[model samples]
Structure formats: structure tokens, C-alpha cells
Target chain A: MAKATSSAPPAGSHAAAPINQSLTPDDKIGLYRLMSRIRRFEQVSLQHYQGGKMAGFLHLYIGQESVAVGTISLLGENDHVITAYRDHAHALAVGMGMDECMAELFGKATGCSKGKGGSMHYFEPSKNYWGGHGIVAGQTPLGLGLAYGLKFKKLKGAALCYLGDGAVNQGAFHESLNLAALWSLPVIYIIENNGYSMGTSQSRSSAYPSCLAERAAGYDMDWELFSGEDIYEVRARTQVAIERAHTLSRPAVLEIATYRWEGHSVADANKEKYRTKEEVERFKNEHDPIQRWKRVLIEEGIASEEDLKKIDKEAQKEAEASGDFAKASPYPTPESIFEDVYWEVDNKTDAGQTGRHFFND
Target chain B: MPRRLSYRHALREAFDEELARDPMVVLMGEEVAQYNGAYKVTEGLWDKWGDDRIVDTPISEAGFIGMGIGASMLGVRPVMELMFWSFYTVAWDQIVNNAAMVRYMSGGKINCPIVIRGPANGGTGVGATHSHTPENILANFPGMKCVCPSNAYDAKGLMKAAIRDNDPVMFMESTKLYGEEWDVPSNDELPDGELFIPLGVADVKREGSDITLIAHGRAVITCLKAAEILEAEHGISAEVVDIRTIRPLDEETILESVAKTHRAIYVEENKPFCGVGAQIAYMIQSTIFDELDAPVLRINSLDAPAIYSPPLEAIQLPTPEVVVEKALSIC
Candidate 1:
């Protein structure tokens, strides 16, 4: 019943349509600001982790900021979101204020998710960001469901699902993609292919390592593969996918070729174990997304070097303030443990649970 | 006056009522549309509600189950039917990691008001893969509500309650009791909310003073039958407590009964290892050790995978005879 379950996308003129430019200079600068914030956020996040101010695994979205900034810029008010554990950049790019995002990493009460969810699980419902799911490919079906909700409500919104290269091989990921296509769900699934799934490189993990989006043909989904080092490139490719989903209510897949500048997480310091130091240095020195975007901002005259530098300073300062805000915020009181387990009252009423309970001595 | 209905009819009536009551309610699962349902619990729903409401999904448990939870997050009340309880392992991450922890981890920002309902016991000759009493496993999570209805009346009332609940509920039903009829209160006979049984409540099916027989799901019937047998054969008037909700387990009813009767014998269709009865035994013993006349005994299914043979399954699952033996031994 899947209309496009072939490995090769259906032959069409839309596939050959030229990528065009719709971004104004102001908008390009605005995107630069967004990318800059994510850049500073990850940079500060690493500093905080190394300084022993942060606990747990921290997957730095250093070179992968464009994927979140580019994909999230296309989303609207009602469009929902789902992403894997590498979510600080996604959350910040989606307008979950810098303080709240950093405070979440610090486990503060003011943080989104009330500090209950750490780095791997930040959710801001006002922004319609579903969660920061930890399980590999676990969030795929949730995005499929969010799309189903939009379709069920007959609304003009869609769902944007973000995953990593390693997640494409998970059973839930394939199942969700197939169903999203078969049901004509309004969803755009973006893969942040940093070449590695944890310590295992995609070449070692996936049976097919060429382009993860090419696998979308098996599910009858429209697919695209593009380099994400350029913010314009990522934005141009994702806009087409987003529009197709909103207009035709179909599923699309985008695989962005990016690189992780750091080790697997804040916990991993041995960079020479799995990957070469020269390779990491090459990607960082030559193909950095922030540096590439900064050059564009200067060359296009969207902003002068001083304006760009001012924006950069402001983003870094904001990232610093987020750490202070988290440090000043309080933790959840111990007595509140029993709260929020259930709605506590009967449906839509203040009447407490009518079910009988034992008398605790 | 109350009307007679089978367990299947009671469940179908509940679904019809909820669907009519809430426009956001949608029922989706494998074979739920044209083929009715694998168990036919959702029969005729596809035609009445059409494709939008009653969706027949492809054979994908992880995808649809996760979708149900995700839809609930967006204010859609999804009542997903698992063909069998044993299939839940395939969607374990959705249930355990996402559905159960969404509210707690999200800091109560959003809740998944989804209901996952289906047959979840070992009497249908459905072999090892098909048969699993997963009340303990599901109830083990903190933010989950596991409801097991014993009879038709309880099934209808608890089904409505689970739907109305603003949290994720694991609504477990029985394949063997689908055709069994009971005196379920019809719509006109009951007042609004009278037929709605809230979760975390315990129901007393039969009252006695000599001993207490506690159980849940289809095992409640076995407990009642055993109570009758105990009364006639051994002059043991046994009280039967049906645990409607396993997680917010009604600790008061069991403790009160144990205190009054001074003897407790727990029964369950699940395996003995980490079974529902194990918790009941420990809780009762810890709370009322001085009140007990004898040790808190347990009668559970054989600690093995469900067998296909009727005779073997009969021996494997707890029976009236086993309940009687445990009751006598405890008394």
C-alpha cells in the first residue's frame, strides 16, 4: 500500500527543480545569529563539562549547528518537533531561550522540563518541541505520531523529525518512515549524518553508507542528500521538503553530510582511538559550518565584520548568562516527588481520584 | 434495571461511548479496520467511525504504539489495541522509556493520555508467544497505570475510567472471558459517573470472614469459585478481593480483609517469579504480620512459558483447585 516504496525516487520534474534563493540579507544575518548562538552554546557547553561544572554525557553539536538552525528556521507555530539526544542546538534554534536551555543542562528548576530532563531530554511544549529522546531511533515513531495528530486535527501544520546517521538502521526508524509514507503523513525527517553512530562509523554500522536518504526509496518516500556545511544549502534543501509536506501532506527525508568536531561526548577524551586527529582537524579547520557562514555574511555584505563580530560577542555573552541563571536557580523540592505522576483528579474536575486507597500508618 | 452483556460487548460499548463522547478519540491497530480486529473486540467500529477515527494500521507495533503515545501528547486520545500482550516487548522503548516517563521527565509540561488495551493472559491455547500475563512488568514503571478488569461490568466501567484518565494506562483484558456474560449496568439504568470506576480502586466481589482470596484479571473468577468451594467443602467463608488497578494497588482493601480474616492466600495467572501475588504476599506480611493467623500463601501459574496443550496449560495456570489448596494450607 506504500505508493513510493522503491529504492529510486519516482521520476519527476520536481526532483530536477533548481534550488532557488528566497532569503533576504536581513534573514541571512538573522540565520547567522541563530547559528552563532548554537555555536557559542556548544562551545560553552564543552567548557562547562571540562571544568567539572556539568555531569553526564554531553554530545557537542559543534560542527552540526547548521542542520538544526537550517531545518528549524523553516518550521512554524503549530509544526511539532522530535529529535535525538543531541538536542541543545535544536532546542536553542527553536527559540527555547538560551537561559532555559543551559539551565536544563545545569539541572535547575527554571530550566525547560523543570530540570528533570538533563542534556538528553529537554522539552518545551510552548514551542511544540516534543522531547530530547535518548534511545537510538526511539523518537522516530513519536514524530510519526505527531504528524498523525496534525493530520487527524486537519490542521495546516506538520512534524519535523531529526535523527543521526546511526538511527537510520534502527527498526523503529524504518517502520515509522514506511508508515509515514503509506499514510501520507505531513512529516520531514532530517538526518544529521556526522559519519559516526556513537563510536561505530556509519561505514561500519550501516549496510549502506553512501546516502541514508537513498534508503527512503524503499519506504516510497521522497529523499534528498546535501552538504550541511553551508547554511544556505541546508536551508534551501529543507525548505522544499518542508513545503512538500505542508502542501501535499506527504513524507520526505533529508540526509545532511556534516562532521562532529569533538569526540563522541564530553566523556570521551581519546580522540585518536576511533578517528584520526588529522581528520578531525581537517574538518574543523576547513569545513566548519560557523566559519563558512561567517565568510558568507561578510562576502554577501549582509553585515560588516564589526556587526558580525558584535553578534558573535552577544551570543557568547548570552551563553554565559545561561550558566549563571542555572547556577542561581533552585532544585525541585524533595516533597514534590509524588506530584505530576498522574492528573490526580477525576477528568476535568477537581474531585480527587475516587478509587480506594489503604490507610498508611 | 441492569442488563446482561458479554465481556466483549461491555468493552465495545465502552469504546462506542468514549468515541461518541470525545471527538479526539481514535482507535488504531493491526487488522482493526476492514478485518474488524484480530480479537474482534473492535468489530464494526471501522464502518461506523470511518478511516479517520478507526484506522487499520500496517503490521507495525512499534510505529503505531509510539504514534498513539505521541498523538496523545498533541491532545488526541488514542485507544490502541495490542493483538496480544506478548507483543509489547517489540515496542518496549515506546512504552517504558517514552510513554511512562514523558510526564515525569517533561516536568509535567505534557501528558500522554493514551490507552493501550488488549487480551493479556494464558487461557486461549495461543502458545508461548501469544500468552503472557504482564501486569507486574507494566506496573513496575512509576508513571504508568495498569488496569485489569475481571468481569463485564468491571471491564466497561474501568475502560471508561482509563480513557478519561489523563495519564498512560495499560488496559489488560482476558481472551477467555470475552464471551462470558455478566449483569452490567446499562446507560439508562446508571447516573452519570456512577458507572465510571476510577483507577487505583479495589472491588470486593464476595465477602467472608474465615479467609481472604485476593486476585486480579480473570483470576478473580477462579477466586470466587474457590470461595464457593471452600464454603461448601471446608466451611471456610472466604472473602474475595479483585485488584482492579495493579499499580495504584488498593492496599487498604487487602489489608482490611487480611486483618478481619486473619488469613490471606493470593492467586494469579502470571508466573510465580516477580508475579502480582509476590507483591501482595510481601505487602500483607510486612503490614499485618501480627494479625495473620498463618503465613501469607501464594497460588500462581507454573513458572514457565505458556504451553499450547490445554491440559498442560490448565496445570500451568492457577485453577480453583489450586486456589482451594492454597487457601486450606494458609487457614
Candidate 2:
């Protein structure tokens, strides 16, 4: 429901007008479909990766589907999103096809990045999904810039920049926070604290008495912490933060408590050493984001078990097809390495024609 | 008629003109705005453009530089000022990892049209940390272009070109030459009514047949001085080639000069180990080995950290005396 605002919202208040919290049945079912698709895609991608179909880093987003889908679902037309390397879920959430994404993982010419950017870098400028930045805390400032660009252009949208618990300690992250607050940039920093910065647990890596979001207090920014198990709660709360950014032109910190079931990367052999099997299983059994959302949909009568199963089966088939597509896709040629190094070169501008751009040339 | 303008004002005029022409262009860095830049290169810009366009960031190089890279991706052309190129180390990951790699990593879908400009020389007695010449370090990156302008004319034109180009340009200015005045054609006097020196083009400061003194930035000025002495005393007319753009180098001009002169000496204020001159010397030897009367040589800053003492620091950078001596040895 839209509440007509008599005047500008008081300083530091929620959005001037109340944001609509209602979700249609299609929207809820769509969320379930996206989450299921991401889970299956990740599982199949992992199986292929283990089978030597893919090389390099594969930071799977299993057990953390709700965070990306929940938060990104609330984005408006002008809104943009950027995130760290655990970015497949966000890429899928932003409506990128599984074929290109899996092809990218398999280093194929038909990949999203044409096999240049593997697991860590997926970009779709048309969708306003900036990239899958590999450097920790590197995208934070870029996120701040996305907001800065919006504010400078007089647009009414926010940039949702997602980072992990490990990135919080980076100097760049702190610097980005100060700049965001200082400029009042419309950015929502979504800290998906998955309880580990690689092998080290959150306690060993980050020094916080309560939670990571509390660090925002130093910057005098609004912040909140919540569980990532429920997609509805994720959507409702993220909407408030997005509203705060859109209306007040303020920055915020939304720490969604998430847990990753896989090792930091496929190569991290010490995943078993740092944490026990029981701890991982317990989180999967109790706080699984997909299972919790499944229960909620059933309780709300939005979808029956059979309806959810249909979505799951369809998701599984799509994921399986993507693997086949990746296998069939041709690998990028050796000579094509010189392409896409510069925009001018790609367009064959005067700058590109003048000098020896590539060393090989 | 072309008038005398300091290298500093020429750079300012480029910024002023570009900012006026493109609303997407913005200048941001520490003390760039209200403080008028650390070296006063950005004087009067804040008052003219106001806080929004002329922003003063904190003492966070990694933060603002990375932010500039990000902003550029979204179509905002950010001229990020690093007060000293030495501080580029603080933001190396952002500059090299992000800015340099973004376009290629995105498979040409995105462009980081950012110009990271600051003084990158070691002549002054600013000690080791402050006095780093990193043109070679930056030019090594394929996606990033490096420009080291030696005079007001090249500085103004190259600054404009770097800003307009659709790629990351690492513009390394010299503190020694910022205040030096040179004849720069007014925009109104130009055929196109705007001065834009294209990148990857070399300017022959002084033409000769005896030898070629190839240099960039302040070292170009040094070579010009050495050319005069070589002609007067040694009776050797040396060609001074200002290879303005390091990457996408003007190899044609350098080779043309060397082919005519039959001897070349690559000079720079950077250290000899893997310096910009190292690559130039190698290119000269490898490409035109038979054209040379003598082996290609290099005149670099005395191999050590920039000295703190005033007199020693003066001698530490490539002087006209050293260039003349090196040229005579080769000629």
C-alpha cells in the first residue's frame, strides 16, 4: 500500500513513503524456482568440476541461495548490483542464463565473458550486474562508485554491493564505508557473513563483539543483522534498506547470516581440518535457506509439495542441460586472447589503429 | 600565435576544457579541491567547478582510486589524482588488478576510462618513498597506457587525449617540469580549434644525424639541453626524440630517428633494472642491429634510491652532462 507523504521524511527515518511489502503468488514461486535452479546449477557445476570438465577456482554458492535471490529480487529498474567471487548465485538471480555461466566455468567461447573471466568474473552491464570481482574488498569502493554515479546523475536508485565476512577487515572496506557515509551515497553494503574467511572461522578472523554490521556504527550509518534462512524476511528487510538509500540517499549495512556448505574453494583441502563434519551437517539440516523457504511456501499455501517438486525437477533438468551445453561449447582460440583488451581496440577506433597495442603484434 | 604556458597551467587548461566539454568527467583526489592540489596543479578548479565535480577525497589512495575505476565503468570519466605516483603502491591492487584488468576481464563489455595522473619523478630531494618514477612499472601492463609529457605543449595535448581515450591511461607528470614554461599553441589557433596530441606518437624535439637521445618526461628536457652542448662543443648534432606515450610506444619514430642517426641512447630518471629505457634499448638492438654504428646504450638515474641530500639528488637524476657524455661515447 502506498502512503501519501505530507512532507520529506525526518532525517534518518525509513523511506518517506512506506514500501509495498506484499508478494504475489507468482513472485513467491519465482523466488523458489530461482533458488532451486541455483542450488542445482551449483551442484551440477561442482560435479563437472570434479570430473575435470572445468579448471580454476569454483566458489560454489550452495546453502546461500536465499541471500542473493531475496535481496536482488527487490531491485528496481535503476538499481545495480555488484558482488565478490561467490557470485554465481547473484549472476543467476540477476537473470543470466545458465548456459553462458556454465560455459564460462568450462572456459568456452560462448561463455558470458567469452572464457576470459572464469568462475570469479561474470558481468552483464545491460542487467546492471557489475561483475564478479576476485579481489577481496575491491568491489566495495566500486559499489560506492555505483551509488556515487546514481547520486551524481540525480537518479533515485541504490547500488547493492555484497561482500563476505573476510572482506570486512580489508582497509579498502573501511575506507569505502567512510566515503559512502561522508558523501551520503545511496549504497546498501550486503555483508553475507558465512562464518569463515577461508579456513579461519569468523571468530579467528574478524574481531567483533556482537556482529559485523555493528562496525557500521563507527561510520554513523544504519545497519541490521538477520538470518538468511527465510527468503520473505530477506526481501522485506532488504527492501527497507533499499528504500532508505532511494529516498534519503543514505548508505546502509545489511549483514545476512549465511553459511556455505562447500569448502572455500574446490582446492581448499583444509576445509575438513578447520571445521568438523558435524558442524557443517547441523547448519545444513537446521538452517538450510532452501529447505526453510520450502517449508514457508507450504505453510503459506502458496505452493503444495507437488508444485515445489515440479519446480525442483525442472531446475535439475535445466542444470543438467547447462553442463551438456558447456561440454559442447568450443574453447576460445589462442589468437582471440588479443581481443577485448581495450574498448578502442574492439571498436577499431583511431587509438586502436595507431600503435602496437599487443606485445605479440 | 602559440604562447608560453607553464606545464602546470597547460595541464589545468586540459582539465578545465575537458570538464567543460564532458559532463561525465570529474576530478577527485586528496587536497584536489579546496586545497588546490598538493602541488597547486588544480588551483582555481574547485572554485570554478564546485564541490560536486572537483571533489577532495581523504588520504585513501586505494579507496578513491578504486572508486574512480568503479565510477568509470558506469560511464563517469574520473580523473583520479594521486598526489604522487609513489603513493600508487598503496593502490597498486586497484590500479593493476582492477583498473587494468576490468575491460579485458569483462571481455570488452565494460570500459574503465580513467586517467590516474600525478607527479612521478625522483629529481627532488623528497627521499626514496616520495621520489619514484613508475612509468615503466605502469607501462608494463598491456591494458594500461602510460604517458610522460616533457613540456607544456605535450602535457596539455596528452592530458586531453588521455582523458578522452576509452581506456585506463597512467599519466606520469614531472614535478621538475611543472613550473617550466614552453610554447603551446592556443586551442583557438589550432586547425581543429583544440589541442589533442594523440597517444603513441613521438615528437622530435631537436633533429640531428649524429645520434638519437630518446627520452621522456623530464629526461626529454635533459636531452634537449644535452643536444645543444653536443652541437656547440663536440660538433655532433644529436636528435632528441620524446617518446611521449610509453605503451603503444611510438616505435616508428624512435626507429626512424635511430636509423638516421645510426646511434641511440635511451635516457630516463627511472632505475636501470627493468626500466623503461631497458625495453627501448632492447628494441633498438633487436630491431635495427645493422643500422647502428655503435651498440645502443642507456643513461638512467644512478642505480639507487633517490638520494636525500640536495646536491647529490641533483646529480642522481639524468643531467644534460650525463646525456652528453653517454651520447658522445656512442656517437
* Local error of candidate 1 at residue B88 (angstroms): 0.3
lDDT of 2 by residue, B1-331 (tens): 4599999999999999999999999999999999999999999999999988999999999888988888888889999999999999999988998899988777778889999999998877789999999888998888899999999999999999999999999999988888989998887788999999888899999999999999998889899999999999999999999999898788999999999999999989899999988898888888889999998899899999899999999998889998888887767
TM-score of each: 0.95, 0.97
The DockQ of predicted model 2 stands at: 0.78
- What is candidate 2's lDDT per residue for A282-318, written digit by digit as tens? 9999989888878877987989999999999999999
Q: Per-residue alpha-carbon lDDT of model 1 for A121-178, expressed as tens digits?
A: 9888888898899999999999999999999999888899999999998999999988
Point to the candidate with the largest DockQ: 2
Segments of candidate 2 deviating more than 4 angstroms: A1-21
List candidate 1 segments past 4 Å from native: A1-22, A345-361
State the C-alpha lDDT per candidate: 0.85, 0.90
Using Cα atoms, each model's DockQ against the true complex is: 0.61, 0.78
Q: How close is candidate 1 to the true structure, as a TM-score?
A: 0.95
